[model samples]
Target: MQMSQIVTNFFDACVFFPRIIFFSGLLSLSGCSNAVEFVQIFTGNNGPTGPNLYHFENKEQLDLSWVKSAMSRSDYEKVLSRIDFKRQVLIAVSVGERDSVSENVQISRISLVPVADDTIVDVSVRVGMVSKECEKNLTSYVFVLGTFEKPKKTLSYGGFDMDNFNAGCIAELSGQPNGP
Candidate 1:
């Protein structure tokens, strides 16, 4: 090949190589922002029947009302009041229904799972009812408090016979704690 032609080809190759690499790198990074993990929760009758995902940047703002109603008034106040929202808390709400008419009930449970960056929690709830020819429905809700730019939401639903009422829900959260 002529000298001028060879020189032109070398410069063109160098320019095109970097562009290819740069575009590929950009494409890979685009997928990272939308990635998230989820946790699962199960319940018996009277489980959470509405929104299951609650997101909060500060732990102090955590709300346990939905779960507190399931227990006695005194017990509810005691258990909920002791919770330190300053620390990370995974809140799950479940409801159980009986064949006979009654008010909705809420059940609450806590775990000592460590909260880490990009952490997703899986909570399971089991609700029970009493009746010989009974039909029960259970629902569950999960709230994750963290310091993310925006909150995240996820949900699942299922039902079983009153003989062994079973239902469930799931949710996820991302980021770190901002402060109290």
Candidate 2:
């Protein structure tokens, strides 16, 4: 079998596989700090919804099956082609569901930290929330694609919520004196 065929088979077997993280939410890392350079692959209010974090080691393992589920084939392919999987890994972060379309998420920063035998991928995300009330819910997502180098250590993903610095919308929405 060809390499692509083998990879396809391997990915097919693991499509339902879920990676376990040591911990998530906010992480504060000490020691040499370096920001992992990343580019936004795609961001929008769409389905395939729910809070999710995914990482792929190579192009063959990167599932585009979700293309038909929530995005266009052309757009997803374009993003896939941009990734040089040989040198970099792919990481995706989803914000799950929101009550209004006025809510959105943006990947603010990406960084890595060494802990014993593993590396923690700390993703800082900024959320935009408006005071609009909606009759239905929307899934807002920011798919990021990047990772650090390897000795092939166990990798964990965590998200740090950096509230949009503007307190006006937050305050108005929460009915609090100041934004939380």
Q: Could you estimate the TM-score for every candidate?
A: 0.31, 0.58
Model 2, residue pairs in steric clash: none
For residues 5-124, write the lDDT of model 1, one tens digit per residue: 998776544322111112312322211122222232222222344434333333344343444343345754554454444442434432221233222222322111112223332233
| Per-residue C-alpha lDDT of model 2 across residues 1-180, encoded as one tens digit per residue | 999999887654432223333444434434533456677666544443455566666666666434223555686677777777777766766555444333345677766655556676666666566545432333343233445443256665444434443222332211101000
Model 2 misplacement above 4 A: 1-33, 64-68, 102-104, 131-180
Please estimate how well model 1 matches the true structure, expressed as its whole-model Cα lDDT: 0.30
Query: How big is the positional error of residue 158 in model 2, measured in Å on the Cα after superposition?
Result: 4.2
Q: Cα lDDT for residue 38, model 1?
A: 29
lDDT by candidate, in order shown: 0.30, 0.51
Q: Which candidate leads in TM-score?
A: 2
